[model samples]
Target: MPRGFWKGLLKVLAFFAVIGGIAIAVLRVWFVDVVTVRHNGMAPTMILGDRVLVWRDARLERDDIALCRHPQDDPARWVIGRVAVMPGGEIAAERGQLRLGRDRVTHDVRGQVRFTDGETRHTFTMSWGTEEFDDYEEHLFFDRADRPFALRAMTRINGLYLLGDNRAHLGEDSRTFGPVQASGCRGEVFMRLTAAEGGLPDEIPHGALDILD
Candidate 1:
């Protein structure tokens, strides 16, 4: 082959490689992207309108905060919560502590949670308790029935159940519906960028640090 022809071919290959790389990067960011809090779910730990970077590809474990789509609702929208259970395991709330099957979990108290559901969003207020569930339970309390609701026998193989730190009063998680499936999970959250003001009261609002790998 001619020397000039070889050089030109190499340049063309390099140009295409660069273009392909850029395209891949953009697609990854779009699918495995970040979400900012428009409302309050993490509360004192995370304020309203905080920016959180999520990892759609990260391996999710118990207690890892994540961004996911609604398992029972429309998958178009995304929400945030922490992993409390694993496949074959169960999560329950007792004395404010989260129970994983029969195992007990302890967690740090961050803030309160206020949840509203349905068409108009029914409001419920819960405080930040001394203890919180650090794991997943199969039996969850149901409002309509006195008995606990048994979760799917098999945990969503692809995803984790996300929940807000403010369990009792927050609408930031699965307690309102059910656990979040893995397919619905977009990614793990790395940072929490909070708004300057307005959402929170007269409090020094600080966002969460990056948790993405």
Candidate 2:
């Protein structure tokens, strides 16, 4: 190649590199959150090893998936789950039923989720049901006819109430700890990632390729 052609190519590459670096900096500092699913607390909804993209400062409402600080004040730790109640709203459970402000979060049984855990090879049978809250509705996984743990009853005090979709892991979220401070939340998990082909077993619900909720 001629010297002029080489020089032009170098300049173009430098310009692109500068632009790319700036974009990445903005994303990491203010917008992007790449979260790895570390536990099966959100089983059937999200499984272990899933990579998720959480957008910072996104407005979170009931039924939205949230990424927040762990209740134990571990700066290195993060907790992700569905928002059961927004700030200042009451969330509770009666017997085995979920409720918010004395209203039941009711839904019809959609189907049964049957999937094998990729890590433990354990098979789970969870009742997939649509839970309604005000004008919004979401599908969630819960214990079947044979309950492993009863849903504990309590009312929300303050902050954001978050809970895992997998009721079998009922103690994994806000139910075990108190509500998470809304201001401390990192963001909303809007996207879930998957491999194009067979590097690992696929475990996400309905084989969803993207968008967790």
Candidate 3:
């Protein structure tokens, strides 16, 4: 090949590289980002190890799945949940059904075991107000001592009330740690990059991709 041919090829490669770098910078700054689910709290909706795309400026609404900084854990760590209650809304859990104002949102489960944190397993029959497991039941129930089935006032304010899709997962949402501040939300999960049949990679088939609803 001639010297001119080599020079032209090098210039083209450099130009494409520059464009790719700019595109990555824009995505990191203002567009979208990818995050891996770290827990099974949002199971059925989002399993553990699922890769999801989060839109930074997406408008949040009730029932939207989102990623937020844990209210009681390290600020840098993230937790994913559904927006059960938005700002300017009153939220409480009566029995196991979630009540936003007068409307009650009940999960669809008929005595199914949703999750197990340890030796203790949680079922849909056990309401959020009831203490089923002798160990850690007090921590899982959100109601205050005075109000048996109602959430504390700390969770009803200028923030969002998030709940795990898997209602049986204890100590995994506003029910345990309180509501997350609006500012603490990282972004709303709008897409799923990769999917698996189970929470682990071993359970995923050779080629399976599922889009989140």
Candidate 4:
């Protein structure tokens, strides 16, 4: 080919490269990010060492797992939980269950899972099960067969009501903190990236990636 033809091809390639770079930058800044699961707060759903993809600036709704910064202890740390109660509803939680206005959130028994906490220095087994709220449900672990779910007071959230899947004392979430502002919640954790070596708990097996519920 002529010199001019080669020059034109190179320019086109450069232009496309610049555009691709810009798109990735925008995605990283305001659209998507990856966060490692440091806590068993999400338990069987998302365990420690689980690298998850967060969709930044997500339009959150009930049952959506919100990714937000830790309000009290560390500003740098990211916290995640399910949007159990929406902003509009009259939030009231009692007897291991949550009541949003008239609708009562119920837990439908759906077997159980036993997994050890890879994040903690102390190793122990945690049993979890799927809890249902009408038709919609999530994998929320209350406790062992002997222990009942602990009750929590409703702290009115103008933005979002976040709750961890593992409702244990160890789970640091809105249970430990109060309700969080929706604006402060960065995004929603929609997918778990493929587990690396020692990336997940031994109990929960996954393939390339996990499309979260």
Candidate 5:
């Protein structure tokens, strides 16, 4: 091979190596998972045709956005919602809802909440509350009327419950399925890259902050 041609080829190889390294680093930082917006399930919070990134192994905090997978024996699917409740915590949904734990409290849809010490209260939106609780219970096998689906506690270390603010009116969610396991969670969402037009109010600032473990 010509001396000049050999040098040029080496430079090309070096450039590709650098590009490959960058790609790997990006993937490691931002765990990529493709989630399909099934229905108006998380509407007003998340819309259809929206693809998101979940920062795997990111520092989790109150009100952090997340992309979660469905529970076992069900469809292999994904849903996007905020971290309503995390591990070692108890979150109640409806008044008569039945959860494993006993501590129950009444909370208005848009009411301000107080968290445990060292925790901050994030202004979360109830994009949609249960529209037809009666309808849902009438057909539920466990007699939802007497026992509302309650994910009262998280026994596991990384348990998380994600719910659509648009409650009953929406489709599948913890209300329908149950609390999502930590293993099912894909990652945390730090930024909404393309579909930034319609999203939750400015209650929580919107930006891409470096995800810390």
Candidate 6:
């Protein structure tokens, strides 16, 4: 190989390497975070093993899907839930319905969801709880005896109410602990990198996706 040709090839490779490194740094510092859904907490909207692209700096909003630290568990472990109430708001659950101030968050039953995996069939009624049915659970209530005896008013100080879409599964969420601090939040889930498939039912009652007013 000619000496000049070798030098030019080396320069080109270095240029491309620098560009790749800058792109990665930008993504890590200010762009996005890729996370995987480890559980069925935000089911239908985001299922187990679904990979998601989260905007690390987007402003949180009511009904927005987000990745945040569990209120009472390991801070390093991230939990996915919807922002039911934002900072400076009060949240409460009454009769299986969420109430924000004077307005009661309402949902419309869209349809039924059913799917089979192997020899097992799973079915449940579907509805939009906050804005989309995908991010919130259909109204499922615990028995009066099993319900929390003292339902405290969750006041968002510098945090927000992070609740799971599958309320019936109630394990890690504001309902189990309290409101989630904003500082513990990682980012807002803007896109699903994984295809919506598998044992999950695709049919929704109303429009496939609709935001509740």
Top-scoring candidate (TM-score) = 2
lDDT of 6 by residue, 1-213 (tens): 999999999999999999988996798678878787776556556656667788886777777777888777776888888787778878776776667765665655444444332122344444332333333444322122233323457664457887666554456567677777777788888677554444554353222222212
Q: State the C-alpha lDDT per candidate.
A: 0.55, 0.73, 0.62, 0.70, 0.47, 0.62
Q: In the order shown, what is each candidate's alpha-carbon RMSD?
A: 10.9, 5.1, 10.1, 5.7, 13.1, 8.4
Tens digits of per-residue lDDT, candidate 3, 1-213, equal 999999999999999999989986898788888898777676656666678888885777777777889988888888888777777778766774456676664332222222333223322223222222111111122221222344554334568888775565656678788778878887888777777445222222212245443
Model 2: per-residue Cα lDDT over 100-160, one tens digit each: 8868777677666565555566776767666676766666565555664344555546788
Candidate 2 residue spans exceeding 4 A from truth: 1-29, 195-209
lDDT of each residue in 20-101, candidate 5, tens digit only: 8898578855665444344544444444444555577565554566667777445567766655556765555455543333
**TM-score for model 1?**
0.58
- Give the C-alpha lDDT of model 6: 0.62
TM-score list, all predictions: 0.58, 0.75, 0.62, 0.73, 0.48, 0.66
lDDT, residue 181, model 1: 75
Give the residue spans of candidate 6 off by over 4 A: 1-30, 115-152, 155-158, 204-213
Candidate 6, residue 196: the lDDT equals 41
lDDT of 4: 0.70
lDDT of 5 at 131: 23
Give the least accurate 10-residue stretch of model 4, judged by summed lDDT.
196-205
lDDT of 1 by residue, 1-213 (tens): 999999999999999999988975885667546466655555434545566666666777776777778776776877777676655566666654455666665544344444343223445443333434433332212121122223333333334655665443345577676777776677677665334233333323353453321
Clashes of 2: 0
Candidate 6 C-alpha RMSD relative to the actual structure:
8.4
Of models 4 and 5, which has the larger TM-score?
4
TM-score-superior candidate, 1 or 6: 6
